[model samples]
Target: MWLVSFLGKTITAAIAAAVPSCIGPLSENIVYPFKVSDNVRALVLTTSALAAIQADVQEKVENAELQGLVQNNQVKQWLDQVEMVRGELDDIKNRYEKRLRCLGDRSFNCWSNYWISKDAKKKSTEVQELRDRGKFEEVAIQITPQVQEFSVGSDVVPQEEADLQEILRYIDNDEYDIIGIWGMGGVGKTRLLRRIHNHCKRSSDFDVLFVTASRECSVEKLQEELCDEHGFGRGTGVVSQARIISNYLGNRNFLVLLDDLWDQIDLQRVGIPFPLGLVNQFKRKVVLTTRLVSVCGLMEVKKSLKVVGLDPEHAFRLFKEKVGNETIHSHPLISSLAIDVVKELNGLPLALITIGRSMYGKRDPREWEDAIDLLKRSRLNEIETTPEEEKIYYKLKFSFDSLESAELQNCFLACSLWPEDFPIYKIKLIECWMGLGLLCAFDAQNIYNPGYTLIGKLLSACLLEEEGSDFVKMHDVMRDMALWLVHTVGIQGINGLCKRGLELIKCYTREVVGFMQSGRHYLQAKN
Candidate 1:
């Protein structure tokens, strides 16, 4: 009897020890009914604290030593590697802990204990690994965050993988030399360049610098940006700036993207080595966006890619995204009409977005109908756009202004005559242009080559889009702008006023902004 009592006491003590460990921390099994709440909470807190420390140390190692650590650094790479490992361990802990809460009241079952023990073991292993890595010391070295936000958020439009891949290929491949993304002003060249820039920075294959060329960019400004990217202080003279930028970049594998390049940029003046010499050493690349193919030729690009507008289905998708369904789907008939109007937009994304947003939040189809009508008739000036839409018109107009010659400008405006989204046959367009006396440089029958060339120039400038093999179509916005320009600038509107026997058209600049006195001058202008 004494022996039986001793054995019972021994077994009871063994079960008591196990109860607080696996089953009690797990909090599900009724068999192990003791409250070990303090122990469980302490363990959970300890694990989280360790993780926090690891993160703190990693950030310090990054910010202190690695300037662009997230983009390129051994410390960043090691932290990422450790994080992935910890993530799997975290998944295991989460699954078991969640199940521990949901487990049924099966007192005799060993399965509960089995899962609880496994979870405990995993946590222990994780904590040990972190401890071995010197987590506490590393985090304690830097205890506070220096920035207001952990990371900035960006929303990029869904881009075609093919285009991005093509860009990546060019940037990576040793075969290609200079890469140029040539398109019209508002065709998302800058956006594409941004995407490429971000990717290259993250990839860390080559150092990347992005520079924007304005209508009046100075050599000193260009030199300053290059120097800054390479960690050189500003220099006073243009030559000094160039020298600093060149000496820094001469030996490194780097990419310099000059966005919105107007004329040929002298990279030599910017302290950039010639492409041939750099290609031989570091296999670096130079990418730029411009409206002119002639600019590509002047820069001597080996590969040039055209950025075209979105397709019909994707165009409507973007339009709907901007407008939302409430405006278009408010009526069945109006939805159909909206689709047709979107088609007339000729799949230009920027125009669709601008026009769509102007019609946002309106439930009535009449507002939409008015929008369609205005879009059809008015060119650049007369259309009613929200404040944000002004930028679009400005950019599109810049492309218009960038035309090489006045003849090309007139030829583009003449395209406004065709109805919205109407495909103009090459032969027919050339004939019209021929009689307009713009294509007089080439014979009417021989107009094919020059006509094709002119069409290409217009298309490359994003003034027009290709419809098919032998025809072209202007974007609805482009056509509207053309007509608007003609009416306002061609004296057609003034001619109409003169036909009605109204004499003088007074133009005022200094009196008030955006003021025009044409119809019986409201304040008796003295011009």
Candidate 2:
């Protein structure tokens, strides 16, 4: 009996100690409903506090999302719960507003009042808990384990691999904000960027945004793409969109990959956070690929990497791969002749691929010999691109020369009339070809098949690139070559107006700008 009494006394003392710590908060809920008007007032106050916190949290979430970040899972759930609690509170308020009166409308209905009061007290507790939980120190978190995987294939030669490593090192360095990759047209700048983009080893904190600023890419168009990605509405003017983009990207770490940039793009105008100092916490980066070295200087790049032509050994390997072993080994001398062709190509990847595909299945040594002589004679002395780049165009010309018919050649050359990187509409281009007597069929409607056939041949020869079903675009190098041919071969009626080199075009642009500013006028403008 003494042990039983002692055990009961100890248990009672433990229960007394636990009640205040454990059930003290729960006890408030028990008594809150009976407080009537106090419960409703408390509920309103808690709801207001929760709503303010929700707005702040919502703003943080939206800003993070605009910076290309995803919200934390816990944060997302909390938001959902907040929404649910808001709906419940609204229902409680509506029920209280429609309260019934009993005892000849002299007093409130006891059961109805108790029911509404109990729900309000419960919801007030829930809202208070939510308000406390919504006090997040950081509303967004970096997405984890982001792996961008790219195939490191045979196409990425030793030099390119070295270039890739160098770029990766720059990305790792804290100092480099804007890294520039510049080379001649078709020297694999875009390809190198692709490798960098898909590389799985890059930092996961950085959200890589790849934008191709082709020769024809405009600031407005670029903004629209960014706005669309950020879920911002467009048709707002460029300034408004720029402000929106600047505000959104200002808070996040990002890597912007701008490919094939022809001119200096205004980073400020485009709304990309620029000139990111070492002091800045956000480790933002901009990697741009351009053909002009001057553009690197203009953009104030921290480090500039130039992608040059492939070396002779790798060049020949790429050429032979495209030409195939069967064709090269068919005749003993054809292997030696293939080396001569690679030499004429000057190790340019575009030239090598174009000429190699053209030479596929050819077993004749004499044919290879003739190709070498044609390449030797095809060099243009006066051109805007460097002497090295000129070699690429002349080497690519071998493919143009090998096209089956004169009509096909004209049709391919005609595509150069469009600006660089312009997407030439297929049917319109075909109609132009038909108008220019480049293609003929039995009926007007039947000309499309031949036009498409010519386009296929051009695409196969690597002259024209297909841009979806309705459009085709000329590779910048190919367009340059066509323009060179237009000038050199005296394609009548298409003179200096359309025949000048790319550098000459840049010079002309500067001159026109100067002329416009200087108020100069010429009655007769010479081509």
Candidate 3:
């Protein structure tokens, strides 16, 4: 043991004499020129002994100033910083493992869930790109659209504004679950409902749905519309549809507007939860528009509002807007005649706008004079061969007559086959035209172009109004005109068709021998 100690001391002294004090910097080996061997072991031992000897010699010759310069308060601070960085690194490693586990865990079924996979991939790509660009201080934000904006302009009747406020108050006061808007045809009930719907949509508190319940409204259709709105998929039966509606609306704040309801809609059948009060769920309200005041009682509307004519001042303003300002400003004489024409309309919104637009760009006072006389004749039921015509029907006829072609006229009239206030899908309308041979084909154009062009013209003329993206509708009064034209005014030679059943068979495409036999049996039974 003493010989080993003496050898170690002698080796340490020889190394200390050979190397300079800066030998501490050469401890890292740049190359491993030697493999494992006895010489390697001896060299490592000698290097360790030299380090110990150097420490002992520094302790014996230590300068207090040099030691103070080497380490002061900074040593403790450096240690604290090192500990904090180590803790942060450990925290980062732990979070990385947790995230990996979250993605890989089998219990949550993350692999099968499309939304989960989509989110994970999307976030992973986003984080990688962000780290690539070194955008640590900023993060990407994604926004989703839930509420729709109301598209009505500022120019509105103060009455409509008042009506809107009253309607909101009705819901706010919790006064009723359903409200009714009743008006004469073309008196702007639909427009009023649109304004109210816009208000509900702008506020993010409720789920708002607007359904047009035309004369052909059915429980199944209402359910289908509601289901489509809720994205519940096509349910099998009425019961299933109702269940879907209840699930979608039972826990949410919602408003449903049934536009142009011709009759009482079965709320329960359509899955609108009634008797509005509930223990914990949000509020639901229903608003409907109709031409019949009795529909209010049928629908059990707790509050009823009548959409009356616009006041004279608003009516004239609306008329001027329909006619260009340039036309009205061309002459003071025309402006005075325009007021007289609008006054003749008696504040009826539809008639005023239609007539005024028809008179647009006519600077002649004589044309305005002619319109006033015509409007008076129509309103008094004198212009028609029949005496029972409504004023709006004639005014709408005037809009119809302004169309560019007779083909357009035929198209507008063809829409009458659809039920009154019923929405006519553009595609279905074209099919109806082709089935009836109403569309005239040209070589260069496709077969449906004529019908589509006519539809656009009608929509621009306001003879046909859009209900939703896919459908268009004739105003109820316009539909009335169509029914009158087809069934009443054009019914001259159709009464004797029963006597000429054989001739009817010739025009019919398919054989109906069963029908002829049934007729023979009915005749014999009657005899």
Candidate 4:
């Protein structure tokens, strides 16, 4: 019995330790019940106790399964947290990439802006330089008082000497307040005026005699000129200056020569005290030269002299003298052609002189034929077909024929497009010609150079007259000739060139449209 009890106590102690380890301290309080004989009961109780412990172990296993479920829930939460952190990290990376892209675009735009600004500044500087050069050229060509020193020829034995003498006698007798000399261009009107002026200057019958050329003929310009010639300082206004001049010349006998008058004169409107009807106090003799016959009638002069061209015999004599008397006698063909050409020139003194000077050394029949042909062509092609076509065409052709280069010929012909008596701006004219591509073949540096050179050549050839600082004028006949060239040559060539230019502009516009469309599409895709 003692041995069994000792064994049972050892077993019980083992159970207590194992049970606590498996479950908790409360597992030691549990027990198993059984009834049996003393020897058998002890064996049976041991078996029953083992079976109960097995049952307890099954209950502990169920509790352990519950704990395992709680641990699995905690692990799942940790996994969810890791996934959330990964999502936040991804968002940060995307934001940084977007900001970097924007910074790159800004850097590119900065470089493009710099280049655009540089190009604009360069273009502005070039334009300013061109404008300055144009202004300098304008100042250089200004007509001033020094041009009066030009040696205008005198009429020695004019055909209308009797008429001139009669007019002078009438002026001497104070028959008319103003006398007008009417004639066509190059008909010796200026020459006659110069003769009259020289005669008046030699005589002391008048005080304060003055001569001035009326190119613009503006009332203000006339007043300014009067003040300038009479030794007056810059006056306040046109009226004041005119009044001062009238007062100065009121009591004096004066002779004034107004050359190249295009419009009728209004002496009263000019602030001259000379009465609108008639005045005897001033005793002023005003002489004028004009191409208009209506101007002569408007003036209502007491005596008017219509200056006609030289007679055939006189024209031949003038031609012979100019061509050299020796050369005229030696060549009958030359002399005959010269006579025909002069007759064709309508006996105009300038026409005869220009032709005589041009044909001075040339005795070739072929050359003479070429000149005659050109003259005939010019007459047919003239825009304003004057009755004096044979004369005017030949005379004008003589000037053009002397030019050496084809470029010079084209440049001279280009001037014919302007209207009759139109004042041309030199720089504007050059710009027009350049726009027409006339200067395309020239060197880039010499593009404007040709214009300056052509202006000099035209002036030297007497094709252009400098009217003022920035104005040049061509003769009526020369303008007509230019029109003819435009209709015949420039229309066809320039029109084609303009069409090509338009096509090129269209092509560039199309390309720009395509580029713009592509840019818009790219922007849309990015958005």
The lDDT of model 4 is 0.54
Clashes of 4: 2
Give TM-scores for every candidate, taking all chains together and pairing residue i with residue i.
Answer: 0.46, 0.62, 0.60, 0.51
Each model's lDDT comes to 0.59, 0.73, 0.61, 0.54
Report the C-alpha lDDT of model 1 over 284-336, residue by residue, as the tens digit. 67888887778899888888898877777777887787678877787777777
Tens digits of per-residue lDDT for model 2 on 1-527? 44533554464455555667567666544443334445676898899889999999988877665554557878889999999998888887777667634322111355665677788888898998898898888877654323345444556799999999999899879888899999988888888987888872364667677777877677897887665444443324777566656656677677788888988788888877666734358878889999889999998999999999899999999999989999999999999999998988777888898889899988999999999988887764435655656666667778988888777777777776565556788887786566545567776667588888888888887788767667787888898788777655444331122113353232222233233224342112111
The predicted structure with the larger TM-score, 1 or 2, is 2
Deviation in Å, model 4, residue 501 alpha carbon = 24
Model 1, C-alpha of 295: deviation from truth (Å): 0.9
Worst 10 residues of 2 by lDDT: 518-527
- The runs of at least 3 residues in candidate 1 whose Cα sits more than 4 Å from the true structure, single-residue gaps closed, are 1-159, 227-230, 277-280, 379-527
Q: Which lDDT tens digits does candidate 3 get at residues 1-527?
A: 44543554465456555666576433212111111112223333443443454344333222221111121233334334434433443443343334332322221222323233333333334333322432122111211223355455677889888988988887665668888899888788888888888887876477788777777689998877654443443445887566556655666677888988888778887777766643265888888999898999998898999988889889999989989899999887998898888777777877776677677788887877887777667665445464323556666566666666665666666676555555677878886556445575774557777767888777766677776677787777777765555444341211111124344322111112223223341111100
lDDT of 1 at 490: 47
Ranking by TM-score: 2, 3, 4, 1
Candidates ranked, most accurate by lDDT first: 2, 3, 1, 4
Clashes of each: 2, 0, 0, 2
Poorest stretch of ten by lDDT in candidate 1: 491-500
